[model samples]
Target: MSQPIPNFYAVIPAGGVGSRLWPLSRADAPKFLHDLTGSGHSLLRDTWDRLEPLTGPDRIAVVTGRAHRAAVEEQLPDIADLNVFLESEPRDSAAAIGLAAAILHRREPDVIIGSFAADHVIRGTRVFEFAVRDAVEVAREGYVCTIGIAPSEPAVGFGYIKRGSELIVDGARDASLVERFVEKPDLETAKRYVADRDYLWNAGMFISRADVLLAEIEASNPSLHAGLIALAEAWDDRDLRGPAVDRIWPTLPKIAIDYVVAEPAAERGRLAVVPGHFDWDDVGDFASLAKLNSHGRKNDLAILGENARILSDAASGIVVSHTNRVISLIGVKDIVVVDTPDALLVTTSEHAQRVKGVVDALKLTGRSDVL
Candidate 1:
């Protein structure tokens, strides 16, 4: 018998507050919507565009909070209205995935689903597609296949996946069974992980047959699994998704898909990792963005100083905007100077990670205007 052509579905989780890249990224306008690279398209638009070949406009689903539904829809007009799932309140990724799984399960029982975040940047589309194709084949065999990016550097900010013995499959590159899942490690540990070559960065891109993930969730976090199932069952009974989400989502436990499902599956020898060769970045913070873009030199957009000596070591000119007035800097150094009507941010490229702390402090002091 000829092999069946796989039907693919995608779920994008777009509910993060983007606390790390504040001042630019706020509660009202999240990170995914921001033009971090000054590119016309936002990160969410980039992600959605990348998935066009795999899921098309109709087959993809976006899971976002009610607050951002209009923006999500506006940015992704290609996606149909019915495919958008607006949560009543913001829950973490685990709940988001569960809800997507439940929704897709009701419609297509045998389809392979790809879960992705809206704020990630992925290069090399062809390589990425190949990896997903390989993952689809792996998921067909009942394994929850996660695309694991081979680490190019000792990144301490992301989770790591330990690969086991390689499994040979026909018509696809060899994949490794997941030996274990590790949280973000320290610098020394990250270096060791890179040197061993047995570890890959957890890209947070998941692929599996709908039934497979549901089964794993049932086996691992039965209560959460049950709650998801209940919500799915009653989804059409009433609009139990909006206000009800805030009341019930907090009780769902603050766990990630890795902890609640992937890790346990790895322990049971059912989880696998597909090696990723594509250039990928989660863009978790402002430092990563500046580094990736290399806005480090005086000529770069990092610095905006008055009568300042700007050294051009690849950094661009600084960008400043206040009300209807625009200010441009001619010379600067390894710094970021942003001036808005209500707020101003000035820092060296090295201290961008502290922006989240500033956001937290703002929230604590009720400085919502600047936040």
Candidate 2:
């Protein structure tokens, strides 16, 4: 068994409401709280399981919204209460991760922090751990290291990372200097990027020293850095934390860590990329969800939950049922049917990415009951 890294800490940022997987994923119960992969554990739990072995429960922390605090605690009972950082309001990735970095740095000056999202599905556990170890090795050298996934297909939905010459860091032999970070591209651009073999999917996983991360944010955004520092200084003090967060969090700029730190760091030759060969899926939409759970089922049909009475005559798609009602499909192809207690969504796989539009429209119509 691989031993845990003494100073390597992990931070799981579980904030986003997965509107794309609506009906199944709600604001109150986001996608990370659901067992979308039929693993008998929530995605958040899976993430904890993935990192706990490396950091243990003590060194792992979760940064989430106040509403999710109870659920996150329930899922990760071993995580200390002090380790769960709750945000009073949504301040985006930069604030969420920066606060965690600042707090961790205050607690342990030489700590190495790796930020991973809570709702990603990864296979090849051994390979994933090895990549993280390599990233940690690079991180200790004062590099902003990111685990870049090898692109299996020309997926335009994810950002791409351009890798430059390899870094000759010990124990991190496969690490390379990150040349650039590109946003989601058109289909043609994605195809060309994949063909070049010089690009990797920006999986949004970063490893760096706590002080280095905070310093990078300070260099790029001093205001955000100051606010985060103020909050972190009072984070452990119960009486001061609440008041400080109330006064500072909302005022902090709402931006992603990519914009505030990673992208700019890449430009300034401060970023490094370690290729992850493990199979991974963010489960961004129902189509991706269907793909992940499409195993041991008859005729390309994927089923979730206790779908006891699912019958497909000439259909091939996925059905996520939370009810015991009989659901049958006759001649539909690549369809997605999500049946929840309060909401039922029926859309084809082709329109899975557009499900966010449905949630937006509902919000505009003042239908918060379903959302």
Candidate 2 deviant stretches above 4 angstroms: 295-299
TM-score of each: 0.88, 0.97
Candidate 2 lDDT by residue in tens digits, 167-206: 9999886999999988999999999998988899999999
Q: Tens-digit lDDT track for model 1 on 29-49?
A: 888986655556888998887
Instruction: Tell me the alpha-carbon RMSD of every candidate.
Output: 4.2, 1.4
TM-score of 2: 0.97
How high is the CA lDDT of each candidate model?
0.77, 0.92
Give stretches of model 1 more than 4 Å off: 1-5, 237-250, 295-299, 302-332
Error of 1 at 312 (Å): 8.5
